[model samples]
Target: MTAETQAAPVVSYGRLVPVVVHFDDLDALGLLHNARYPVMVERAWTALWHERGFGFDGDWEAAGDFCNAVKELRIGYEAPVNRPGAYAVHLWLERLGNTGLTYGFRFCSADGAMTYAHGTRVLVRLDAATLRPTPWSEPFRAVGRELLRRAS
Candidate 1:
């Protein structure tokens, strides 16, 4: 399907994670620095993952599920964040595969009425020892399914 004709992915409110745009994240023009967008999103995702008990605690063997690495990221700016304040990063699973998954996200106003940016992030699960692509664990997939977008 053409870009214009493609259906927008459904957003899951349960996956919306609140984030703050700090003063340091702003540029001389008083707008959010372009480079900070992905950083902010990463922070949000990390927070979410931590909340779900996914993180490395100095043990390589126990960090398999959290060994995922970003393979690709694409963002489209829709508007500039004019000030440092409360915002949100809505996240949802776009595609889930054996060794990787694509996540859709939007940086938007707190109420989600205005989108500042939107994008997709592709991540590949990795084997803890080999540090190579590996299939995601069933537990990880189960958690991801909760944020997965429903088929239209």
Candidate 2:
């Protein structure tokens, strides 16, 4: 789901993948360990970028600058699924400012019966070589805003 392929309504933020919490993903307390939430969010993030055509392949990086998200995330855990099932993560974005973009997510039961988690992430564009902050161009900005708007 790269920029080369226009985003469809179903893929406003790139993807909606189901995550099954394996037995190995739990802690002694039987709940999903807190550390796992970040990894979960990261899975969504990577897919979103790739679906919208902003992946971090060597060629893409070599050709142009990209966003390095400095995520300020907040995850709220709901029901405990020691043996978590197929949880669907609905991805969306909040807004895009000159320097940053905010992405939102709702990880819920695939059947929509219950919610597992909810959160948001902050990202910023960077120069390829220097890896410093840079303004995203109009086209990229448009794409981001469009996705964020639809999701919101």
C-alpha RMSD values across all candidates: 7.9, 5.3
My TM-score estimates for the predictions, one after another, are 0.87, 0.73
Q: What are the per-residue Cα lDDT tens digits for candidate 1 across 22-130?
A: 8988999999999999988888788777878787787877887778789999999999998988887888889989999999899987666789999999999988889
Highest-scoring model, TM-score: 1
Residues 20-138 of candidate 2: C-alpha lDDT, one tens digit per residue = 56677789988777788768767766666565776566554553425465857777887666665455566766888886788777766654456777778788777766777778877
Lowest lDDT block of 10, candidate 1: 1-10
For model 1, the stretches where C-alpha displacement exceeds 4 angstroms are 1-14
Alpha-carbon shift of residue 97 in model 1 (angstroms): 0.8
TM-score of 2: 0.73
By lDDT, the best candidate is 1
How far out, in Å, is residue 135 in model 2?
1.9
State the lDDT at 77 in candidate 2: 80
